[model samples]
Target: MRLAALLLCLALPVAAQSAAAPDDMARRAAAQLQQAAAGLERAGSARDRVAALTRTIRAYEAGLAAMREGLRRASARERTIRESFEVERLRLEQLIGALQSMHSSPEALLLLHPSGALGTARSGMVLSDVTPALHAEVEELRARLEELATLRALQDGAAQTLEEALRGVQEARTRLSQAISDRTELPRRVTEDPAQMRRLIESADTLEGFATSLASLPADPAAPDLPDFAAAKGDLELPVRGTVRRGFREPDAAGIRRPGLLVETAPGAVVTTPWPATIRYLGPLLDYGNVMILEPSGGYLLVFAGLDQVYGRAGDVLPAGSPIGLMPGADRAPAIPAAATEPGGQAPDETLYLELREGDAPVDPRQWFRLDED
Candidate 1:
């Protein structure tokens, strides 16, 4: 029922412009956007404004993504229906001509066949079957044409809504960023030593070395203990929403294997901490782009690399699902290319490198993270 209401809202005109009837996914997009808007409205009153704004931004992102996929489906379906209609065009024209001739012919003349009475009776039986089949084919063709038109109109009308959704998500992201910068509620797990952090980053030439050095740093004596990391094995969520493009120690194009999982996500997607953890390091290191190293427990580190921007600071303890960073890219909603919008198109543009380490040894992150596989 909620979906139906959203669908009705999607069908309404914007700025005196009529909207096309939405598909199921389009209806879903509408609902998600509505939810995001509601979240945004209530964010000012929420206890944790950053979390509320994060949720709003995520909702907007999900809605925009759905709308994009819906447009792609509509385009593909329209192309298919148009192709089918063209293939049947000549046959349909001939059938229409024959039907018109038969309608104009005298009733007795139509009954008389070039054969004897027995043959005429058989011919009548065949005509009775063929007539219904022909009518059905004509009806099917009509329906396909109508569907094609609807799809085409849907793609046309969806552009404005897509633009609005994109703008809304961007605004939400901006608000979330500001909120995070102003946030100071999280506890500090360690005292940051600029010199020590600089030495670790400058002296280490590899991820393993950097991670090992970070682990040797001391935590504050007064810091509170976090939940057991080992107990959450196989139940932790991925830091970001994406598909695992490569598994742990998986070989790349050059056959060089890394002890991490490569996750492909949409450009500028949000990255969060999946568990309560303290930030040990957050910056560019080695060849792993922008990285955020977290110590969820003693001797256990979760590393997220390839971010566009990092949030919070070293030693700040974050609760689960806290926005830690964003994947590298512009915040604008994607204008998917023709090939990408097609069925079974290329994967998303950005890739995040994730690794879990226990006492300086890399472990299979898939074993710890519950992933939604492609």
Candidate 2:
């Protein structure tokens, strides 16, 4: 009787093993599911999705392994219990039969086992009593499931927001590139004709003055200051339409006999003041067919020559872009022959000469005017 009681005590653990595996498996599955859901929520882009999915799958696979191991251990223990209780086990046999019947039916497995059959002396210590550890693990798993579900929902919403932001950035970049292309091409198309080129030059000169004035003004006091010339230097547009017939030279040939700067433009083309300036001279000079000298508000002198007509007289405060003259006859050295000359000899071509002087010395106009990339 003593040996039988000892054997029955050992068999009790084996009988309990059946419930252990499934509980462990459920716990592991729950933990993995939670981890996967958290990863998904933090994902930001396509790459993020891949990373989250990889981690999630790994967790699930680990849980699956734990579950399989638990199930295997439980099955082995159940077999042992059945074999041990084979003889003089009428009561145990009936319990095993009931257990086996319940196992066979899916619905029965879901229900808790009855307490009295487990052989516990305390009515409180019943088959229905789950181990505290198992109960805690189950609760942990349930919490994780809820967290994962919430995380997954958040991840989905974030992914959509990221996709929309990416699309908007791409569209804006495309439009900006197109605008730059159009601005670059405009100079090329209009420069072919001398008359059109002159107009473009006048516009460019006026814009350069406006940009310079803006640059002279102090930057917004509240905004951070950028490096000098960062906002102002390149902001100015090209000041002439015709190709740079002659660039800034060390011993400037286009300068007055003294030394200054000069740019040859098409004759008869309107010469607009770059800045608000007063006309100082407007008449013929030694080599300049028609000369006009301006004293600009910014303490600079601008001299224009080779004009077919003059619109502003001396003492006139000319605004920027104000038409000053028409291009000269063809006999004059043509600044833009292709643009100024007609098919027949009906009209004469003209050229423009520019000189920028600071006090008495000449500076490089190229530094101020925007040059076409050749």
Candidate 3:
């Protein structure tokens, strides 16, 4: 009887050791499961959440296997230990089921598991001391999730604002392009003949008379530099660089005979004056597609026409050699022999005609330009 009691004592310790191994494994699995749940909640990106969930599944599998192995080796008197393990297994099964449900419905998971859905365990009591640590981890994760959600909202709002601004800029550019197209067509409607354009010089004479009258009549003591005709006559320089194509002549049946020196220039070239002058006129004129008339100090009227673009405006004071406009078109008129054509070859089909005037008449522009001598 004593021998049987001794053998029983030895068997009891062996059974206890076997039970302890499974219990330790179960505790470790529970701790890992809790840690993984917290990690999923705290994860800032999708990849991080997936990794945490995977780790939790591995731990749960290991613990389950250890518990089964312990039960197989346990004795009859230690059946209570086996029964306790069975209860734990059932609890784990329920947890895994809840996780599966959450995985199927992310929105529902977010609502039910604000702490975050787990891969193996969804809802279960861990060891007593472990509960506090698990709660702290969950709270930290909740805070991080809230921050991520707020950032996403702000980014969406910013993208929408930028899209609206880009749309406005596109609309404005379309309107500007349309306006330019309209302005380009203006010259086609105004003048048909060069002779009529020469007749228009009468209007310029009328304007000069008006200017002279105003100069004589004005005198507020504060009014600046009243027009000095003599000073004006000597100070201004020629407006462009080119040879005269037509010289001033008496009016004939064909047209008011050329009343100014028509300067010929290359197409698409920049037009400018050799001296500063105030812009007197800027727009379409008879026989001139686009025109700019500048009145320099000496009653010198500098005229430029046949332009594709105008960079200045009426009343602007332009510096010497400043760009006024680009010449129009690319095709150059074929040069016909002087004897084979009209005296100056002044025809509508010709590509050149930029006239200049001084006071009421035109002068030989060739005499004023020093650069042409070279």
The candidate that achieves the highest TM-score relative to the unseen native structure: 1
Order of quality (TM-score) = 1, 3, 2
For model 2, residues 294-372, the per-residue Cα lDDT tens digits are: 6553335566766655654444554444444444542342221221122222223234666666544455666656666
Model 3 bad stretches (over 4 Å): 1-241, 250-256, 331-367, 371-374
RMSD of each: 9.4, 29.4, 34.8
Q: Residue 313 CA error for candidate 3 (Å)?
A: 1.1
Collision count of model 1: 0
Candidate structures ordered by lDDT, highest first: 1, 2, 3
The candidate, 2 or 3, that scores higher on TM-score is: 3
Clash number for candidate 2? 13
Whole-model lDDT per candidate: 0.77, 0.42, 0.41
Pairs that clash in candidate 3: 232-297, 232-298, 233-298
Worst-scoring 10-residue span by lDDT in model 1: 9-18
TM-score of each: 0.87, 0.31, 0.32
| Candidate 1 lDDT score relative to the true structure | 0.77
